[model samples]
Target: MQTVELTVRRTVGRSLVFQTKVLEVDANRDDPTIVVACPEGLDPLEHHFDASIAWTSALGRMEYAVTTRPERRGRGRVWLLTLTGPLTGVQKREYFRADVSIPVVVSWTDGPPAVSASTNGTEPQTHRLAGVVLDLSEGGVLASVSGVPPPVGTQVQSVLRIDDDEIVHAATVVRHVSLAGGTGVALAFADPSLHGDRLRQVAFEAERKRRRGD
Candidate 1:
């Protein structure tokens, strides 16, 4: 009886996110379905509405997209979610890393690049560098930048364009390596702020597209 997080969103409303216990997994059927104990007082989930489920596993957080329906069993209601796609394995950090190439702009406050100016209570000068995000995850991104790369531990801001959406994140340079044309650096998000869900969705979609060779 493992606990899993469930999220359901109607086409025109906010998402419903809650924790539920896994009751059963029926994988033998044409469309595998997972049965989970419904939370008390929850409205019946919209029939065949899309849902996302996540559970922590030994490898990491695992996520799945499903079509949900309410079912009755011995007077207790349960959620029957049919698998709509392959399970996505998020890493130990609870974020799925996607291999992608997208344009990015990394900026840092001028001065000691390692120290954020907000800590000193002074108006900070800013500098920007153009880069291409080689890979992205909910927690961070690996990017290739021409010219000099920022040192490890430097705090910076990044703007990433994915499709028609633009995401901005406060990040710290975590790792770097020399490359033939430029330097590759990894920036871990310091705080995802209001864009956490957006980041996860983007990473998931990118991973799915990669798997499908799209």
Candidate 2:
């Protein structure tokens, strides 16, 4: 049986919108698989590929990393890649064929501009960026933000740690929408589980309250 190896690719731009890059994966002719390597500094989201994806011979994209290039140290460093598609698993074998994506600070000091949402009654903090999330794999997140839409194939670090554990990560603004009472925005995340215990706790409490009508 032939297998397909999936990897993530990404891009970093001025803004953290649809700035994802697409990589050229050598599609397997005999095996119907694509094997790509994980670039430096990036990681893959782990829980987004649990369904049957229609087999398409098209290449996909994702985010990789943000680093300070040695040569360009003065200007700082940021690198991202676009992969063929999200990694998939071979039946019940080794989970999924994924790459490495770096996780951002729920709210770092000099990190990406993050929108702080306190779980407890704590003071509001910051992360990196904020916007709608797109795709999430394992390593990091992909997001879409405000302002003019970004070009296709551009991956930006666009997530805000609203809470301590349950920070919203890897998201994208699907499109700009208008609502009767509010501004409509769309987003995506890497994986609900990767969000940590706080997010899960919130979900659990919500469910419990709903059941009790509290």
Candidate 3:
């Protein structure tokens, strides 16, 4: 088990440590922070002015020494944090994942070439397919569908619809095959920056919900 420690800093720059385990770090994005869950029967914000947070990971002990402000986002049970300065520590990355099901549209450049009667440089013909994302990470997604999917190495664009929000991303089909229930394919994003942060947040949110049995 991992724990997160919040050290409070007062106007005099003095500090105090408030340790808790009910925290989630959303570090895959450009701006990283720890989401701390408010302890039962107590309000954390009331006890601290500005604070610094630290935790340990695969890399080693990681610390965000800069003073940070906490904002109440989502429900009052949690606080979203933002550091005022650069996070100082070894950045050892270990990927985390969450099981989810989402509908998406996949368009790929794997169709047969067309012998056009006109000779003006032609673009590769593309095809569209629909699939359900079984699970997703910042780097890739596993989509389950019916029938044979595009061959491995196919360059694809996936539009994942999260409620009314549509996020478009570029990916490559790394694996495609038949399953007992349906065809399954693994897609690794060409560039995760297009949707990595958003997907990471979604995965974290899913984990939070599951932990609460919601």
Off by over 4 Å in 1: 1-94, 112-125
- Candidate 1 clash total? 0
Off by over 4 Å in 2: 1-168, 175-177
* Tens-place lDDT digits, model 3, residues 134-185: 8887677888875568888888888888889988888898887566688888
Q: Rank the candidates by lDDT, best first.
A: 1, 3, 2
Q: How accurate locally is residue 115 in candidate 2, as Cα lDDT from 0 to 100?
A: 50
Error of 3 at 12 (Å): 37
Lowest summed lDDT window (length 10), candidate 3: 13-22
Clash totals in order: 0, 54, 0
Specify the highest-lDDT model's number.
Answer: 1
lDDT of 1 by residue, 1-30 (tens): 776667777686556666577888888998
Kindly provide the TM-score of model 2 when superposed on the true structure, using C-alpha atoms. 0.26
Q: After superposition, which runs of candidate 3 have C-alpha atoms over 4 Å from their true positions?
A: 1-94, 111-116, 120-125, 177-180
